[model samples]
Target: MTTPTLGEFGRIARFFKPLAAGFPGARGLRDDAAVFGVPDGRELVVTTDAMVAGVHFFPDDAPADIAAKLMRSNLSDLAAMGAEPLAYTLVTALPRGLDESWLEGFAAGLGEEQRQFGIALAGGDSVSTSGPITLSVTAFGLVPTGRALPRWGGQPGDRVFVTGSIGDAALGLEVAYGRLDIPAQDTRAHLLRRMRRPDPRMGVGPRLIGLASGAMDVSDGLVADLGHLCEESGCAALLHADAVPLSEAARGAIDGDPVRLALAITGGDDYELLFTAPPSASDALATLAADCGVAITEIGELRPGTPGEVVVLDGAGAPLALVRRGWDHF
Candidate 1:
């Protein structure tokens, strides 16, 4: 028989079974519905994110990187909620002219991530699409009920925190689009890799368990993503522009003035976590960073809720305008 398009059960059984088996408590992918249970008194955290080629990934991306990033992007969502990964389900649409090689690379990448995180595939649907390939994955996790952080729990004085450097992906996109030519050696590799495979702050999630009042992953530009946090937390934010981390790679990619740099912040696809915790919990972050072995940066603080307003502050707390508005899915 010819290669078959994915039917409901067929595709789910094939892909999800393997993925589910990868996780410990993931019931066999053979039930009416996924029979899932969390630790008693612990709540479940679920998040979904979709990536479309030309929108999320370059049509010319290597299969392995695409698969890896796809999984990471979804997991990043759970990270924002301070959830430990349990399992996930993916629905992918493929373009025609499939090849075994591409599938192999894709599976290989997924397999690597599966091994890294104790998560398994659950189930999903797949089919041929008219244009670009798209992947939508829903990830599951367990968090203590009263401890899970969300995007709307911040108070006015909560200190804003971001994991790792920002704008690497934007710099990566510049290299991808031929806008910037990376010089040889280390910087080029750094920028390229940042665009391709982003490291999610997986370890930090547990530390944020009950500490952060509000949190989210920074898939959009930093400024834009920060705006989202403000909106969710029912507050406004004044960012110390000087404090916004900029990579040497990003700076080299974009010359003076953080205009182009700001673009990278709002351009999306960074996948870092942006969160808010009360100022009293400052030591918790430093200790958490040390305990989790990850770099955590404090960005800003939440103010009274005000929609449609974000001010980039100088070290002296003055306003600055930004070029890009960050990522939008519309």
Candidate 2:
């Protein structure tokens, strides 16, 4: 006999309503839309991200992991803007007759991240799709008025810094694809975990308000995202390849191979915060990093030149060539 499946409204009531229990604005998922107010002296910050099954992840990947990654990716955007988590709305598009267990696991994952990040589900729509499973999250955050960070705030002569090590997620993707041969099980696990669930720098974002002149998360490859900052700020950048931090796993994966190193920088999905600060703020930034317990490394400098021109220098200070800088949706 076939197991009974929860219909649309039944699924929402069973799996999603509890996720909104903490937020009154959600109206227990009975309302047509969410109603909320921003706190006094704070402005709302909003960001949305969408993921497709095959393109973003393996269709058969764990439902819980998929939820965590989706939530954290949106939270990473909020963190880049120096915002604190508030609430979020979700949209799920699944094929007809999908297993109810998938929804159960997905909602469980969302519930776990909600508590961990101090956010709540507001309201959302669930629909049946003819194609692959698709998920979208629109997250809301709040920041002090006039204090949200900007991508165009970088100035020439500012020092560029990144929170946490880079390249692990990129290598993790290779591991997921069975393209990289890593014999060490622990190292392999670390890479795979980083790729699956990214650690958003929420703790560091708010503290970067006056410290970082320009800030953004590294969702795209580090080099490409830095170039985006340069374009927005109308400046150029000089990146020191040797200064880029790498985790033990990433280091082992690269194993002194320049091609792999290039892949690491360009493969994307790191989700770390990349920001620029004036040289004068160096000491304060150092203190902030120590306080937040997240490693912040100075990897490069902004300069006056053609906008968006990123010159990467190797350990020996020679220009390095890359076939491509980052992932392109187009």
How much does each candidate deviate from the true structure in C-alpha RMSD?
Answer: 2.9, 1.1
Compared with the true structure, what per-residue lDDT tens digits does model 1 show for residues 39-81? 8988888888887888878877998799888888888887887
Clashing pairs in 1: 19-120, 19-121, 20-121, 221-265, 221-266, 222-265, 266-326
Question: How many angstroms is residue 152 displaced in model 1 relative to the true structure, after the best TM-score fit?
Answer: 1.3
- Best model per lDDT: 2
Clashing pairs for model 2 are none
- Poorly placed runs, candidate 1 (over 4 Å): 1-17, 24-33, 254-257
Tens digit of per-residue lDDT, candidate 2, span 171-209: 999989998989899999999999989999999999999
The positional error of residue 146 in candidate 1, measured at the CA in angstroms, is 2.8
Best by TM-score: 2
